[model samples]
Target chain A: MIGFIIERIAFFAAIGGAGYIAFKGFSAIYRNIMLGRKEKLAGNLNTMLLVAFGQKKMFKRPIVAVLHFIFYVAFIVTQIELLEIMIDGAFGTHRFVYHLVEHIAPLRALYVFTVSSIEVLSLMTFFVTIIFFIRRDMLKIPRLSSIDLEGWPNMDAHLILLMEINLILNIFLMNTADMAVSNGAYGLWLSGIFASAFAGWDVEILHILEKVGWWGHLAGVLGFLMYLSISKHLHILLAFPNTYFTRQTPNGYLDNMESVTREVKLMMDPNAAVPESTEDGPVKFGAKDVTDLSWKNLLDAYTCTECGRCTAQCPANLTGKKLSPRTIMMKTRDRLEEVGKNIDANGGIWKDDGKSLIENGYISVEELRACTTCNACVEECPVNISPLNIIMQLRRNLIMEDSNSPAEWNGMFANLENNAAPWQFSQQDRFNWAKEQ
Target chain B: MQVKEMAEYAASGETPEILFWVGCSGSFDQRAQKITRSFVKILNHLNIKFAVLGKEEACTGDPAKRAGNEFVYQMLALQNIEILNGYGVKKIVTTCPHCFNILKNEYPALGGNYEVIHHSTFLQQLINEGKVTMAEGGLFKGKTITYHDSCYLGRANEIYEAPRKVLEQLDAELVEMKSCKTRGLCCGAGGAQMFKEEEHGRIRINEERTQEALNTNATIVAAACPFCNTMITDGVKGKDKQASIKVFDIAELLAAGQGLENIVL
Candidate 1:
C-alpha cells in the first residue's frame, strides 16, 4: 500500500509539473502572436481541410510526402494509446482498456486489431524517423542543410527526430515485455518476436521493464509538449490557423497605400475635402519591426516548419542571391521572440530599445533588395505562409520611411513622377510608334 | 494603319468597342513596336472599332508600385484614371502583362475600373468568334513553337491557356518548357527589375528560363508579354542561337499566320 501511494504521488507530480510548464510556454507564445495587428479571417474551415488536414502542398515531392504522411498518421493513431497510458499512469492501473476487451467479444477482436495496427505503425514511424535522419545528416539535401540552418536550427531538427525514435522504441519495448509476462495473444505479432529473448527472465523483472517503458514514453511525450513552443515543431499546432487566415487576394496584387490614395484624390479634385486623421499618434508608413506587421504575418513566423521548400524553389536563392525565404521567416520569428522577452521584462509594456528588426542586422538591406517579389516563395509554402509580403513591407519602409532604396530604384521613381513612364521619353510622344506605322 | 483617339470618337459622338491601352514598351521600345504593329494589323483586318488614349495615356504605374514608390505610383495612377474617366472608356486591351495586371487587379481599388483583357486573350476570343481566321498551311504551319509563360500573365493572373490557344490556331506544335504555367519561371523582368541592373547572381533568371526553352528544341519561342519577349530575345542572343531560334509575340505569330507578315515590323 505504501509503495502504491508513493508511485501514485510520483506519477501525479510529474503530470502536474509538465502540464504547468507546457501551459506557461504556450501562453507566452500566444501573447507574442497577439502583439500583431488584427485582420479579418475568412474561409477558415476550407483552408484547414485543404492545407493542414489534406497536406495539399506536401505532395509536391512525392517520396517525402508518402513518408511524412505515414509518420503523421502514426502520430495521430497513437494518440489513442497515449490517452490510455496517461490514465494508467495516473491511477496506477495496468492496461486501462483491458476491461472493455474482456467484456465484449467483438471489442476483443477490435482491440486486438487496433493494438496490432498501432505496433506496425510504431515500427514504421521508427524506420521513417531513421530515414529522415539520414536525409538530413548523410544525404545533406541542399534545402535541409543550407548555410542559414546551422547551429540551433540544425540541432533542433536532429533532436526532434531522435525524440521520435526513442518514443517509438519505448512503445515497442513496453509491448514486448507485456507479451512476455502475460503470454497475451493480442499485440503479439511484432512483440512476440522480441518477447522470446526475455522468455527465460523472471515474471517480476518483465513487469518492472514494462513499467519503466511506460513511464519513459509518457515522460518523453510530456517533455516534447513543453519543448514545442520554443522549437520549429510549433508548426504542428500553428499550421492550421496560419493557413486559415492566409491572404485571399490574388498573388500579384500589391495593396495600395490609403494615405497615397487620399493624396491622389485631393490632387485630382482640388475642392475635395480632406478627412482629418483619426489616429491617436503620427502614423508610420510601413513595417520597420514586428509590431508593424499584421497578426497573420506574425502567425506565419510561428508556423514556419523550417522545411526550406520555399528557399529551394526561390529564383533569387537558386541564382545565388543573399535572399533565402527560409531565413526571412526565421529572422522574423527570432526578432519577435526578442521583442516578446523585452516586453515581458518590462512588465507587459514594450520599452523602447535602441535595436530594431531592420537596423539591428536581423535582416539586412542586401537580403531585402535581393527579393524579386515573384510570389514563388508564397506559392511554395506548404502552410500557405507569405514571406514575400513581409519582404515587401520592409522594402516599403526602406523606400518611403528612410529613403534608402537603391539608386536605380530612386531614378525609376523620379522617371515615373516626371515623365509618367519608367523611361526618359515624353508623354506627348507616347503614340510615336503608331504614327510611324 | 489608322489608330483613332478616344477624344476624336467622343467628339464625333461615337464610342469604340474597345480601348487599346498602348503600354510604355509598346509605345516606345523599338522591338516591342513590332508587336504593336502586328496587333493593330489584326484589329484592322477584323474591322473591329477600337480607339487609343494616344497622348493622354500615361504609364499605368505598375513599375512604380512594384518598386515600392507608392507616392509616385498613386500620382501616375490617379492621372491616368482622370484621363480614362474623362473618355468614359469601357473595355481595354493591352499587349503588356504588367499593364494588364495593374489595370485588371489594382485599378479597381484606385477607383478606375474597366474590363481589361490581355491581347492574347482578346485574340483568342476573336478567333473563337470567327472574326479572325487563320490561313491553311500558314507561315507557322508544321513548326514546333515553344510558348514562354510570362510571370505576370501565367502565375500572377492565372492566364496560361489563352496564349496557348492562340498559338494552336496557327497550326503549329505548341511545345512547353519544363517549368510552365503555374510553375513558370520569371524572365528576370517583373517587380520593376526591368529598369534596374540585376543583383549579383551566378546566372541571370532569363538566361536560365531561355535555356529551358532551348532544351525543348522548338523553332520559335513565343511569348505574350513585351518584357518576356525582350528577355527571351536577349537570352537567345546570349546563347548565340538567335539565328536558329526566333522569339515572337503571339499576336505577331497570329498576324503572320493570317498572311499579314508584311505588316509585321
Candidate 2:
C-alpha cells in the first residue's frame, strides 16, 4: 500500500511539475511577443486546417513530405496511449485499460487494435527518425546542414531524433514486458512477437523491468515537453497558432504606411486641416531592433522551424549572395531571447543592450541589399512566414534613418520625384510612343 | 493604328473597353517600345477601342516602394490615384507585370480600384474566346518555344496558366525550363534591380536563367514582362548566343502570328 501511495504521489508530482514549466515557458514567449509593436491579426480556421493540420504545402517534395507525415501522424496517434498510462500511473494498476475492456469482446478487440497499431507506428517512427538522421548527417541534405544551422540548431535536430528513438524503445520494452507478464492479456501483435523470449525470466525481474520501462517512457515524454520550450521542436505546438494568424493579404500587396499617407493627403490637399502629430511619432522609420517589428513578426520568428526551404529558393542566395531567409528568423529569435533574459535579469525593466538586429553581427545590410523581393521565399515557406517583410523593414531603417542607400537607388529616387518616373525622360514626352507611330 | 488618349475619349463623350496602361518602360525604352506597338496593332486589328493615360499618367510607384522609400512611393501613388479616379477608369490593361501588379493589388487599398489585368491574361482570354484566330502555320508554328514566367505575373499573382495557354495559340511546341511557374527563376530584374546594378554575387541571376532557357533547346523564348525580356536578352548576348536564340514578348509573338509585323514605331 505504501508503494502504491508513493507511485501515485510521484506520478502526480511529475505531471504537475511539467505542466507548470510548460505554462511558464509559454508565458515567457507571450511576454516576448508583447514587447513588439502591435498589429491586428485575426485567426483563420481554413488556413489552419489546410496548412497546419493537412500539411498541404509540404507535399511539394513527396518523399520528404511522406517521411515527415509519419512523424506527425504517429506523434498524434501515440498520445492516445498517454491516457492509459495516466490511468495506470494514478491507480497503481497494470494495464488498467485492458482490464476495463476485457469483459466486452468488441471493446477488447478495439483496445488490442489500438495498442498494436501504436506499436507498429512506433516501429516505423524509429526507422524514419534514423533515416532523417542519416539524411541530415550523412547525406548532408543541403538545407539541413547549411551554415545557418551550424551550432545549437543542428544539435537540436539531432537531440529531438534521439529522444524520439528513446521514447519508442521504452514503449516497446514496456509493452513487450507487459505482454509477457500478462500472458497475452492485451494481445498486442508487434510487441507480442518478442514476448516469449521473456517468458522464462523471473517474474519479479519482469515486473521491475516493466516498472522501469513505464517510468522511463513517462520521464522521456516529460523531458520532451520541457525541452520543447527551448527547441525548434516548438513548431509542433506553435505551427497551428502561427498558421491560424498568418497574413491573409495578397503576396503582392504591401500595406501603404498610414503615417506617410497622412502627410501625402495633406500635401495633395493644402487646404485640408492639419492633423495633430502623434505623441508616439515615428522612431527610425523602420525596424532596426526586434522591438520595432510587429508582434506577429516576432511570433513568426519564434515559430520558425529553421527548415531553410526559403533560402534554397531565394534567387540571390542561389547566386551566392549573403542573404538567407532562415537565418533572418533565427537571428530574430536569438535577439528576442536575449531581450527576454535581459528583462528577467533587470526586474522586468528593459535596458538598451547596445545591440540591434541589423548590423549587429546578427544580420547585415549587404544581406538585406541582396534580396530580390521575388516572393519566392514567401511562397516556399511551408508555414507562410514572410522573411521579405522583415528585410523590407530593416531596409527602410537603413535608408530613412541612416541615409544609407546605393548611389543608383538615390538617383532613381530623385528621378521618381522629379519626372514622375524612374528615368530621366520628361513626363511631357510620355505620349511620344503613340505620336511617333 | 490609332491610339486615343483618355482626354480624347472624354471630349468625344466616348468610353473604351479598356485603358491600356503604357508603363514608363513601354514609353521610353527603345526595345520595350516595340512590344507596346505590337500590342496596339493587335487591338487595332481586332477593332477594340482602348485609351491611354497619356501625359497625365505617372509612375505606379512600384520601384520606389520596393526600394524602401515609402514617402516617394505614396507621393506618386496618391497623384496617380487622383488622376485614375478622376478619369473614372474602370478597366485597365498593361504589358508590364510590375505596373499590373501594383495597380491590381496595391491600388484598391488607396481608393484607386479598377479591373486591372496583365496583358498575358488579357491575351489568354481573347484567344480562349476565339476572337484571336491565328493563321495556319504561323510564324512560330514549327519552332520550339519555351515560356519564361515573370515573377510579378507568376508567384506574386499566381497567373501561370494564362501565358502558357497564350503560347499554345502559336501552334508551336511549348517547352518548359527546369525552373518554371512557381519555381521559375527571376531574370535578376525584380525589386527595382532594373534601375540599378545588381549586388555583387558569384553569378548574375539572369545568366543562370538564360542557361536554363538554353538547356531547354528552345529557339525562341516567350516572356510576359518587359523587364524579363530586357534581362534575358542581355543574358543571351553575354553568352553570344543571340544569333541563334530570340527573346520576344507574347504580344510580339501574337503580332507576328497575325501578319501585323509592319506596325513598327
Candidate 3:
C-alpha cells in the first residue's frame, strides 16, 4: 500500500514537473525564433544539425566526443524509458513499448543493445564524474586548482559536480535494480559479476531490495529533472533549439550587419547619436548583461553542454592566451545573473555609474578584444555558438563609444578613413595596378 | 532594409542591358581595375553596350557599415542609388565582389531599385552564349594554380562555379585547397577586417588561409576579390616565400584565358 501511494505521488509529480519543463522549453524556443531577428535562421538549422545532433564537431576530440555521444544517445533513448515509466505509473501498464519492441526483432535487439550500452556507459560516466569532481575539488587543475570557497561557492564548479553526482547515482541505482530483476538466473554480463556477492540473499529479500532500488531510481530521476531545468546546466532545453536553428552557413561572416530600423531607429547623422556612458544606461552596443545580449547569444550560453569542445579547439586557449571561449560564455552568464538581481533591486547597475561594461569589471574591454574572429570557436562549438560575433559587436561599441580601440586597430581605422585601405598606400595608387599594361 | 530588395530589383522587368557601377575596389585597386576593364571589353565584344558612372561612383560605405558605422553605409548606399537612378541606369554591374554583393544584396534595403550583376557572372554568360572564346589563350606550361573563393562571391552570392569555370578555361590545373567552396576559410580581409587590424588571437586569418593554398603546392594563387588577393599576396611575402608562390586576380587569369595580355590595358 505504501509502495502504491509513493508511486502514485511520483506519477503526479512527474506530470507536473514535465509540464513545467515542457512549458519553459517551448518558451525558450518561441523567444529565440521570434527574437533572433536575422534572416539566416533557416540556414543555421541545417549546419547546426551536423554539429549538434550528428556530433560533427566532436570528431576533433574522438575520445571525448565518443564518450559524449554515448551519453547523448543514451540520454535520448532513455526518454522512451521515462515516458514508459510515466505511462505505466499512470495507466497501470508495466511495459509501454513492450508490444512494439517484441514485434521487430532487430529493434528489440537494438533496444536491448542501447540499454546494455547505457549500463556500461553509466559505469564509465560514474567514474568520469567522480574524477571530474575530484580534479576540480581536490587536485585543483591549473586554472582553479587552489581556490576554496565554502558558503559562497564557485557556482559553476559546484553545479557541475552536483549534476555529475546526480546523473551518476541515478544511472547506477536504476541500472542496478534493472540488472537484479531482469538478470534472473543467467544475469547481466557486467553487473551480474557485481551481483554475485549478493547471491546468498533470500529471493524474497532480493525482490524487496529490487523494489526499493527501483523507487530510488525514480526519485533520483525526478530530482535530476527538476534541478536541471533551473541550473546553469540548462543544455537540456537549449540543445533542441540550438540544433534545430543553427546557422545554415558558417557564422564567421562579420559582413555589414543587416541594418535594424524596426526595433531601434538608426540615426544616420553622427551628431544625433545618443551614446550610453555607463553599463546601466540604454546599451548602444555590446551586451552589458544577459538581457542586453542578443537573445540568440543568450540561448547559446544555455545550450552549452560544458563539453569543453570549444576550449579544447580554441587556438587562444591552447596557446596559453587567457581567452577560453568557454570562459567567455560562462562569465557572461554569471555576470548577467549577478547584474540581473541588481537591475531588479534598482533601475540600473550604474548611478549613471562610472563603472561601465569595462569599468564595472563585468566584461573586461580587453577580454572582448582578445578574439581574432577566426571561426575556430564557431567551428568547434557543439551548439554552433558564435562568440566572435558577440566579441565583434562589443568591439564595435568600444570603437564608437569611447573612441577607444587598441593602437593597432586605430591605425587600421585611420588608414581606412584616409586611404580607404589598411596599407596607408596612396589613394591614387588604388587604381595604378589596374592601369592598362 | 533586406537583401531580397536588391534581388527583386535585379529581376525587375525593365533591367537595362547593363549598368556598370565601377566599384571603389575596381576604381582604386590597380589590379582590380585592369580586370574590370577586361570584363568591360568582353562585354563590349559581346555587343553589350553598358554605361559607366566613373568618377561619380563614391564609396559604397561597406567598410564603415561593417565597422559598425551604419550611418555611413546608409549615406553611401543612398547616394550611389540616387546616382544610378539619375542616370536612368536601370541595370548595374561591377568587378568587385564587395560592390557586387552590396549592389545586388544590400542596396534594395534603402529603397533603391536596379538590376545588378558581377562582371564574372556576366563573363560566364557571354562564354555560355559563345560571345567570348577560350580557344586562343596562353597556357603557361610550368604554372600550377589554385583559386581562392571570396566570401561575398562564394558564401554571399553562391557564385563559385563561374570563377572556377573562368580559370579552367585558361587551361590551368585548378588545385583544390582543403577548405574551399562553402567550407573555404576567410582571407581575414572580409567583414571590413581589411580596414581594421585583427583583434589579438592565436592565429592570423590571412596567414592561416594562405598556408592552406600553400599546402596545395600551387605556384600561383588565383583570387576573385582584390582585397583577398592583396592580403594573400602579402601573407606569402610576409612568410618570405614569395618566389615560390604568386597571387593573380581572376581578371588577370581571364586576360591569360583570352591570350590578351597585350590588350589587357
Residues B159-264 of candidate 2: C-alpha lDDT, one tens digit per residue: 9999998888888999999988889999989888888787788999999999999999999989999899999999999999987889999999888888887422
Q: Which has the higher TM-score value, candidate number 1 or candidate number 3?
A: 1
Please give the ranking of all candidate structures by TM-score, highest first, separated by commas.
Answer: 2, 1, 3
Off by over 4 Å in 2: A273-284, B262-265
Tens digits of per-residue lDDT, candidate 1, B1-265, equal 7889899999999989999998999998999999998998889988889998988888999887777778888888888888898888889999999999999999888889899999989998998998877778867667899998887887678888999999899888888888778677778888878888878888988898899999998989999989889999999999999877999999988888887755222
- Give the top-scoring candidate (lDDT): 2
Native-referenced DockQ of model 1? 0.73
Worst 10 residues of 2 chain A by lDDT: A275-284
- Candidate 3 regions with alpha-carbon error over 4 angstroms: A1-70, A84-201, A208-216, A226-233, A242-290, A306-328, A344-384, A405-436, B1-16, B41-47, B113-115, B119-138, B155-161, B198-203, B262-265
Interface quality of candidate 3 as DockQ: 0.12
Top candidate on DockQ is 2
DockQ result, candidate 2? 0.78
Model 2 chain B — which ten-residue stretch has the worst lDDT?
B256-265
Native contact fraction per model: 0.67, 0.72, 0.12
Every model: iRMSD = 1.2, 1.0, 7.2
Best by TM-score: 2
**lDDT per residue as tens, model 2, A1-437:** 89889989999999999989978888999999889987888889999899999998899888999999999989999999988998898888878888898999999999999999999899999999999999999999999998879989999999999999989999989998988888877899987998988978887888888888899999999989988888888889888988999888878777767677777788888776656656386435888999999998998898899898999989998898888999999999999999999999999998888999988789998988887789999888888788988998988888777888999999999999999889999999998988675
* Residue A348 in model 3: lDDT: 38
Better of 1 and 3 by lDDT: 1
For model 2, state the Cα shift of residue A346 in Å. Answer: 1.4
The per-candidate count of clashes, in order, stands at 0, 0, 17
Whole-model lDDT per candidate: 0.86, 0.89, 0.61
